[model samples]
Target: MVRTLRTSRASRALRTSCAARPEYDSAPTGGRKSARRRTGTAVGTVLALIAASAAWVVGAAPSADALPNGLALTPPMGWNSWNKFGCNITEQKVESVADYLVSSGLAASGYAYVDIDDCWMAGSRDAAGRLVPDPVKFPDGISGTAAYVHAKGLKLGIYESAGTKTCAGYPGSLGHEQTDANSFASWGVDLLKYDNCNDDGTSAQRRDTTMRDALANNSSGRAILFSLCEWGVDNVWTWGAGVGNMWRTTGDINDSYGSLLSIFHANVKLAQYAGPGGWNDPDMLEVGNGGMSFTEDRSEFSLWAEMAAPLITGNDLPNSSAATASILGNRDVVAVDQDALGKQGVQVSAAGGLDVLAKPLAGGDVSVALFNENSGAATISTTASAVGLPASSSGYSLDNLWSHVKTTTSGAISATVPGHGTVLFRVSTGSATSTGTTHALVGASSGRCLDAYDNETTPGTKIEIWDCNGGANQKVTLTAAGELRLYGGTQCLDATGAATTAGTKVELWNCNGGTNQQWRPNADGTVTGVQSGLCLDVTGGDQPAGNVNGTQLELWNCNGGANQQWRLS
Candidate 1:
């Protein structure tokens, strides 16, 4: 079949990424605009594409129940081409970097993925209407490049778009998902970074899901890690794990400190969405990009590592400075990123321009980040209890993640953090209360108890406040996984249907590890729904305490209200 030129209708959908390193597109202003890369001019970019492109057969792809082969159990570490070379990538360039990753000691450090972004393909498909690599750039094609990279003991990653044309205006995988997936798998590709560009009117979710299914269903034995690059549209973080190994949760990151910080600040709140087999990618790393000082670069690396992000280096490895090398090789820091527990950190407290972020690691240790975003150095303090240590612990043993020094604190740990810098700590504490021990969730306002309606154990039974009776129903256990369990751990205090509204019903449901079933007990005598960010509250505050019995419980704004406070006693 001969190739042909056709005019794509003007896409009402938005186009977005980086432009000449300028402020072409800023950090995410809204969900859609900030999530896209620079769109190539549609006309000249694709002079000719195969007129017989594969049909968009959604049914022929993999089953929704099927998953990509088991890989990226932890966030993947590696180097990428788009951030540094963009469309200037050549097979030799990738091969050279792959060699550097091995010789430079990055491979042993677990930085092994070498990915090529868009523009690797020729303008026209091959005789079979399959995508082809540029002969000039790779006389041997993608399979050759993959073999070269694999020979270096490193994995290979390829890029494509869910749209008709990629950001660079090359043919994408929209209708040819199965063909591209099979081609990539046949090439022995280990990763797929699928972007959303020139998508026309197709929804990001559907497009991304299509590619995910295709990759998962590929007949090749290779387990390709699917990275959905939708720029966090539709809050991809909440459901990205069902489709891909990792999903970009922010706009593209540049070399500047402002860009780094903007992306970081925007993404940190979505930490709960990340875990083993799934991660929130804050785009690629700019560690050796020369836009910011070594301090800022180190801070950037620390924050991303603390959040358990994929450590995909976007710097020129061969020309990296000593500082960049040091930042990348900090084994202790990388350990935090690759923790076995796979829990992403969260911002626990922020005051006076100082923010405290905490990630609970495996083995009862908590990673703490005292981040100073203010102009001058500030003394930041947070107690072990403040960071969600169990009530049984008196203090924690702290280790400096960067300096590798150990210390212990009986109460609060205070440090003077430089402006735009962070003091990272790994705090280990003793075991928490046993799972079977019952605790009364005493309300601050009414001084009453959080009681299940009529002591009912059935699902959907409403929750209400009652007098402190100390009965089996009034006594609930806080499981180590953050679930508040009633009925001897059989039923959980669930937010009805996972609702986040203030007046939504709170009920007893079968114990499941869903996010809505998890609750976070804070140092401020308040309990918040880990998934919804709403405080557990007693319905009416005006009623006198003695008469408050039987008052309905609801999720309300965290206003330090007596009604919204609870003590696990």
Candidate 2:
């Protein structure tokens, strides 16, 4: 069976179960308040600021106010020790990160909660069956580390598996839910990352039980943020809201562009469960964490803002350089993380080499990020008047969040980006009009895809459609080789490319001097079909031949095959 999304509303039936250096009243979440929330059970409504002492079952479905308190975690920024240090995590490390949080000014910038990931525990529990910190690693013990973090003005977080063993094969919570929760709460723990790797894919009983037990242990009214790391079991998002403040919808992330992009694309639409406290976590940010580049790191950070994900950093804080610190210190982008609405943006459309991700911000403004995740350099032109804004966002005009630059984009927001790059913008509108189409398409120019300098690939290459880019597919560059080159990159049109005859396909093939891949557009709207000696044929001559998604194209006996024809409308 296809893997069903475990984050559906139904997944909240599992009951799983921080902080404040502030005189601040809780922030109202969601867009302009609709109605006052009547609190009773897990009321996740906008007005239900604090939760009462009613216990809940893990994944136990709750009312609209299901999110426990104001901790659904909009800006769950903290330091983690997995990606960089791996099993080298020690109490000293956690405590030092807490120190960095306070001293490096990260805590003041809204970065709190220092967490210890896998391997902080000894190989086995004690005779009393309680988890023990490795004497070598912690020296003092789990409680000592939590106390140290608290002294440093940061809350402490710990990790464990819901299964028989933690990811590192250390002692886990498994059947000892009550013991683990009691021990965690007793140790002054503030956050729990209950991973689900070693556990058998058995039933949801374990899920419900462990989560319930944790809630039972948090009787101190100290809201426990349960982070279910079940990797999309039973459409986890649906039931996840009832379980914890945040749950990871996907698996652990690597510090690579491909991995980051894949995870972001796979997870969207669950942003509704996110607010001030409840979050849809896309694992931890692998930014500035050694695995990916600066470009990849920027994109990863940008995506977290778009997804409204928990901004837990899994890198060594003490070792971060100036560049890394700057990437993490973008207060404006982080504001998107704290955008109160907590709505995760999604990939609305794709063309050329650009992609558009939109998240609704607090107040009336909407945050939109236009990212270039392609290889070569690229650009895509989009009219701001067409992007849900009225007159380029009121007083300050258009604001670019990532760069913190402000400009009047009353017409269009055209951006030039390096390959594997991005540009993020927050379009604020008090009374702006939503415009054009649901998703705007980028111009398909002529260029082999290209980097900053020139075409990265061989000239006269095939023309491929990347995320909406203006490189070459948008800009046609007729080549001297009698073949057309997408001005900047590789990818030529394939003439009668498919093996099949009738329901054959047409795509970007090689520019091997083939007729099937040649075409010329006239001064008028008509594009002369040079390849296959026929205009782009709309095989079977059907308009709106979609919904049955596998439709193919063939070079029809051209009676000016309408199906093969497209006029960039």
Candidate 3:
């Protein structure tokens, strides 16, 4: 009989927990209200003044607030010293990486944070029960090191475990949330990657939320990006949005091709669970680590970029090889990873050890990756229709993202991918249209069609942009009740809290014909919010594809741009 490996058993653990944040209240200021009243005279003027005041009051308070600092709008890109240096981390080493990130053009390419992973902490807590940097390894202490990193225009990230002792037997933040949070903030820590080792009986929410509240309510007023490194013990992806900006969804990845592919296969299924301010992390990247071939390394980076995963490098940045620098410094690949849409790629079709994945990009394009799992080269092919693109009489245009080459094909895209290698393409169709009675709403600016995030039919599931694959999540129908109903469900697209001003997030809820759910199409290719009379505009005003994603659908005054232009079907 075979025994289960510790890693395999740990991967199977799944549980649940709950936590809450304290409420905050603020009333409108007296001076602003008095100024509005002084200008009121006629009955129409009085009503307008009262309406403006009410709107102001409503806008002043958040309805269902989650994050306090509201940072990490996109998946973070940085360098993590774990897979390479591990417990051998030193302050001088971290400082050198910071310097190299700026000098070697990685920081300029959008890789910012320089994170010092585990073992940088002392063997024990201080007299006040607060964490202390290892004096021997970090001679300048965490504060001085943070100052040095800040001076280089790069943020600093520190690591800790949620239990009494970290994985390396160092003091953790189990029962000293307040003290540790304050200490980190005072030390100028910009981000925290909290692990879950040694957490014997602690609930996921109990352990993680304690730290989240401590950081959010810290006295220093420093906003730290919380990265949950729980190793997927509780299906963290299910409820991580309200807990942290990013959460690890797999076991630790070692510096090998097997480890990389294992983590990728595990985390790829969680695409819909990720969005702006929240991400599904497969753990830190192992790029440029000298374990995999250059081809495999390219495949790894390409897949991560297509998935919109964090681009954290875990290699020795200062002594990087020329080939490694080329892979990490490719601006085009980085663009796909940092796309403003923030949608993760999804597996569209798979068969015979060959898989085809598609990612809907911002500029009306789709990124395709043909991956082969075999040990030898294999031919893989998929048609445009199979990936949700309507057939075009003029055919499809293709761009090899890795090679930066452009070409056109009539029908199916076929390529011979090497063993464990990938062929990535950006595909677009010309003169495309749909004839169905009900149509999927596709953002002309984002190219991503409207989607019910996570494919969940629950009320309050946010409506977001995802790779459009002609699934039920992208289908919607207009009803006689003046409501746009989600296809195959009783829910309508409802604005969160019925908010009227710009930036009100849209979600799916029960169909009640509420004014907030009413939308009408205008002749100028704009969708008007019936209650607010504002155009439904894409957040970033259509700044071309591959710019930034996570720009939510908001209400703005009618402006004729591709962002506000919604192509039905």
Candidate 4:
């Protein structure tokens, strides 16, 4: 069954205990009706009390419009309790997991956060209206557990809903956001997995932003990573970077190969939304879970790393097998996920149940994954040039991340991947030419070359589309500094005013190596500006018949149209 349809054991117990309370009747229901049913005068009274508290001083609160807390510089690598222990979590179990994370070498390998996922709280709030840890389940309280985790040099994460009740029927932080944020900050929580269950009809953005502001304004002066668990509704990725460190792009993941593959497909396309402080979370890792085969588990880990998804393992680490440990502790594979460049892998090609993905790493290395999704083994192949490595006569070095075998490839990056398996390689382009490679930037739709208007060498000359006549003005060189140089390396293609908005003009300027002049040639045959993230376009090229010689060039949204596509010929 899908994870969303499954209820935790603690939720059932909470339902039985709260049967007499009308407000608790809406624990399972979400949206508008549930909001009206659960939030009565008591919620408003509690908010009023919180607002009147000296802690709510207006000037101290961080701006709600501020950028996300700079916590997860890379996609978070950790373990969460929901997928395995669920609502059965206890202080001892959490402490034990922290122990295993350190002792099993996973911590040293990069897994850090030991996250508690729901049901650790009592059925009702205390008389003071503060959340209380269940005395039986968490004998030492959340603060004690966090202290234990912190002692082990790790961080602790806690889960709560944005509505009146959590998915597992625990009291959520919806209207009680500031109170709960203060409680979490006091407990020394390092991360907050804010779930979307049992939410009021309020817009997800507003509710999430409310809690984000609450967390920021907490008096403890702590920086907690905010993880939005809205399950991809409302295009969370589009605004998640400004609100949270990582955002879920799909529903909860189960321990099955089909679930893994579906989530991978759902998340791989969101590469542009992922970066240093924010990530596209495809739910937690099920590596040690029994539903998938060894090959499938390895494939899931490899793909998640390639896509730069948070490596939050959701399994019993203490009792995990040696193979599971090896897979989870593979330093080479983990390095790709934690690469400093923080570029998520993009699908280079996919067809016939075979796929190739490429991620650019810091220092000119690219991580390539050859995946076979069918029921049998197959050979998947792509060239170094196809994966965005600069062309070179000396060839590239391919380091098989999983096998730890090194080999040299003149250009081809092919692998015979088994069914439901992935062959991941780190392709080093150290031997590739670094000074520059001159080529004609030919527009795929217009069949014209990128040219300076009137062959002008003056700065601020408009770049335009013209017939490919092999002239010096049309010859562009991609350099090691990421600049698109023209006019015999004296002039560079630049986005006007370093603007990031669409329709920014492309102009020729002296080569001073500004970010506006930096261009990245994506595998999809589109060139994007480093500062703007906009594609080089032949004006009106979306309409096949509109583009002509002397048509102006501009930076526009990447619509995957033929007009935005280009060839470095």
Q: Which candidate is the best by TM-score?
A: 4
- Tens digit of per-residue lDDT, candidate 3, span 316-367: 7776643455457656667767766667889987787698988776666777
Taken over the whole model, the C-alpha lDDT of each candidate is 0.71, 0.55, 0.69, 0.76
Residue range 183-272, candidate 4, lDDT tens digits: 999999999998876766676789889999999999897899999987777888999888888898876677778888888889999999
On a 0 to 1 TM-score scale, where does candidate 3 land against the true structure?
0.65
TM-score of candidate 4 relative to the true fold: 0.66
The better candidate by lDDT, 3 or 4, is 4
Off by over 4 Å in 1: 1-68, 390-395, 430-569
Backbone N/Cα/C clashes per model = 5, 84, 5, 0
lDDT, candidate 2, equals 0.55
Q: lDDT at 426 for candidate 2?
A: 72
- Kindly report the root-mean-square deviation of model 3 from the true structure over all alpha carbons: 21.2
Error of 1 at 259 (Å): 1.5
Which prediction has the highest lDDT against the true structure?
4
Worst 10 residues of 3 by lDDT: 54-63
